[model samples]
Target: MEKYTPLRTATLKPKSIYYPLHIRKLIKHKKKLFKEFKNSNFGLDEYIKVSKTIKHLINSYKSQKIKSIVSNTNRIYKYMKNISQKYSPIPCLENDNIFIFDDKTKCNLFASVFARSFSNLPTFDPPELTPCKFMHALDDIEFNLLDIDNILKNLPNNNCCAEDGISYTLLKACHSSITPFLSDIFRLSLDTGIIPQSRKVSYITPVFKKGDKNNAENYRPISITSTICRVLERIILNSLLIHLEENNIISQNQFGFLKKRSTTTQLIFTFSHWYKAVLESKNIDCAYIDLKHAFDSVPVRFLLYKLFNIGIRGKLLNWISSFLTDRTAKVKINNTFSNSFQIHSGVPKDPYWDPSYF
Candidate 1:
């Protein structure tokens, strides 16, 4: 029996079984007290007490959520690292005639290919989309301090951080110090006609697209930059969308990136439109246009001209043009790093900014 080292069997139990009933009742009672405090005309002392209690309760809830978020992000990061190990940088075409695997060679090759593809004409002419007349004055647009809070609130606490390693969690932790600085940057961009330097740098990831693995053309470039820049971009995007909405400028046929709109909405709308056409016995045809790397292929000079025509004039126009210029990126694959290269084209992909840019 001593040699056997007898062990008792353990039974698994649900988490709910472990929660003490007394603690549960106390929690319920506190919640009731919180509701009563909010509803009643209490004295200052009572109000302060209740407010502290409420804040304590909220903080406890948030702390639990933070734990879950950190755990999940850790898991996700590990999974990504594991998956990334399966695919390392390979020998890609140096030109149509040659192939090379060195990180520097690959980096330069990718940069040159995209730069050539997206190069603007020698002259930076105004874009074609500039409207004939002003629908709304740019200066008349108002920016509220509360909009800054809203932007911060919506930021995903766990997301791709830029070169600075400033995660949303870090930003949120230092929001008091960060907010004022960011606000000033936003105002200064609007005031001085120069966008911040952070907005111009992107960390490029060469995600594989459908094609020959050795061909650089097969990879689609995705940009991840500073969350701070993303926030500023969001502010600008919101302004742009408002201007477009006020002017009724967006086409009904287009359903990408607007509030409460998606590719699914467009698909449904198209099906209905075609179904009605079929029911009415009307002969019709439709064409689908899919430009490979459509977003990256657009020339910045031409896009600026389009925005100019659309009533984004003066400093606002200049800021947008400046935002698009002198942009750069560095590629990463496990530990092998590529040299920073100039990105001459492709609107940087921020979910908030890309659709509006087009």
Candidate 2:
């Protein structure tokens, strides 16, 4: 089979893959006209016309190409990278009546602001939960080769390195070779309820939010952890989800995080309910409340307690608790690296291609 198969090598294009011959010709013509008649109005006007036409054509082509490649992961990733916001170096940050000019100092300032936002105080008293009885015993979590393979294959192909200096693209390339080793490591971690210190280390990026850029409070932390850790977490998530679905722990009314359910589905369900009420001549009342710093403010102890009450007991619960605790992150502002600091609470808010996390 190897002898009979023909090998095809991909070649990089000098121009955009979406650019056509006519567009290239028009661009060349525009450049030529600009160089030949730098001081002439007619030449300038002709160049401007050609430039506008080229722009329109390029945008139209790109739009159509995007629609065609919507389901193509590689193409979609490229387009996303092209359209993503360019990184602007953060200037001096103002904190507590002082201006921080050093990159490391700026990072520490942002980190401190984020850490201070995480509170141990409970917003409201949560009812104590009793251990849930399940039909089948789920005492521990485990990952098989198939589970690891699937998770690795589904990972984003981004080359952004985590704190461990491993990129998702490299991980995907080595998945077939490393699946067995990963399966063993994940199983051992689950059984011992201990996570590696390296996996727990995260690089937190201070992304600018809408406000004065100098204020440390105007930025949010985006944590990027080890690629291997993410894979293991996916396996754990699968196990927890299976137990949740099988025991019917998740309510039907709750649409977030469930398969085939999204904000769009939630809106549809809500609007349908409202429409039915309108038909019956009933008034509809709706109130939308946004929780400030929801993810960052969640108390770790309370979260673990809630999970334990919901049947995530034994080693799995312990593993999750360990996963959350003792984690440390360093602020990454451009080329500057901050000193490592302990993360006291909240889940890591990693950026994803989907709208799930802002």
Candidate 3:
């Protein structure tokens, strides 16, 4: 992919992957020098040059592994995920009221806690919401074989597999055979408004955050849903987004997930807006609302009502409702697994495209 974005200014960084790997080579080489050479060893200087070359080689490997886009970026994500799991775990806390240590117990404890924390019932009636007046309903959409092929082509390889034990790499390799089946599946989902059973199951892995490890709240749940489900969702999400944009449903000031928008873009916009307004002799009030755990806090039922209230109608609404409901998760701790439980509220954010439900 082209590096179209402007380059970021350089900052201080580690010399290399030396803190963990190359330094060992240095020490090992020093030991070899003492044993193999007499006083005033000439090989030490040559070894230093070799060590510097090795450091650059290691840095090059790391740089290629951690590129900012998909495909390459997943390498770094997987590497860090593995390291983080080993470094920080949600072990059963001592004397914190819970007593568990084995993988099964730990998995169960994590699941139960995250479920309760994220799927809380609404305390009050939600505010009324409606679609933009300019919005037009998207009628029954059909996915052709080409569309399905494109979806498969775009899926990143080596991703965490879903319950079906299928990775994108496998799917991409066999897309010719799978295309016909997946196309039909996508069409049937559109026609009947139900996702495949395989798509609904998620494998939840708990990643440690901070605070008490015994308390499940200290860890974040990173779910892996069916790879194919993600592709299906991507198709739907794109259409919905086009409808929203054409109708001007999304506000200009909303920059959280929009394309070409980031923390830096938001910051620049804010300062630029205020400066421009000051020169124009206009006063403006700035207010910020930080919705904690916003994605998990969404009320699916109310959101569905609003979707239908807006121009969203017909099987499309039903399809979205199906996407939002009947999802289940099972927690995995090491080799042990827990019984699957229904996800009562909020969106399923395991799959990359799943978060676009909001």
Candidates, ranked, TM-score: 2, 3, 1
lDDT of 2 at 264: 83
Candidate 3 — which pairs collide?
none
Displacement of residue 154 (Cα, Å) in model 2 is: 2.7
Q: If scored against the real structure, what TM-score would every candidate get?
A: 0.66, 0.77, 0.73
Candidate 1 lDDT over residue span 1-358, tens digit each: 3578687866643223223454455566666766766778445565566556655766676466456657686666754564355544555554667868677677766655555555544455543443545566564244566777777766776645667667777666666566777787777877777765766777776777777878888776777787776777778778877887787777787788788888889889989989999999997798889886667766787777677666777777777788888887776553444667676666888776775676
lDDT of each prediction vs. the true structure?
0.69, 0.77, 0.74
Residue clash pairs of candidate 2? none
lDDT of 1 at 354: 74
Predicted model with the maximum lDDT: 2
lDDT of 2 by residue, 1-358 (tens): 3599788866543343548889888888988988877766557777788889999999998888889989988889977877673657888988778988988888878777776765445657666776776666466865678878887887887777776778899889898999998888888888899887988888888888888988878887787888888787776776777887898877789887678897889999999999999999999999998978777766778877777766777888888889888878888887787877787767766432111211
Q: On a 0 to 100 scale, what is the lDDT of residue 142 in model 3?
A: 71
- Which stretches of candidate 2 lie above 4 Å from their native place? 1-60, 66-81, 119-126, 130-133, 350-358
Q: How many clashes (backbone atoms < 3 Å, residues ≥3 apart in a chain or on different chains) does model 3 have?
A: 0
- The candidate scoring highest on TM-score is 2
lDDT by residue (245-276, candidate 3, tens digit) is: 88887778877677777677889999998999
Two-way TM-score contest, 1 vs 2, winner: 2
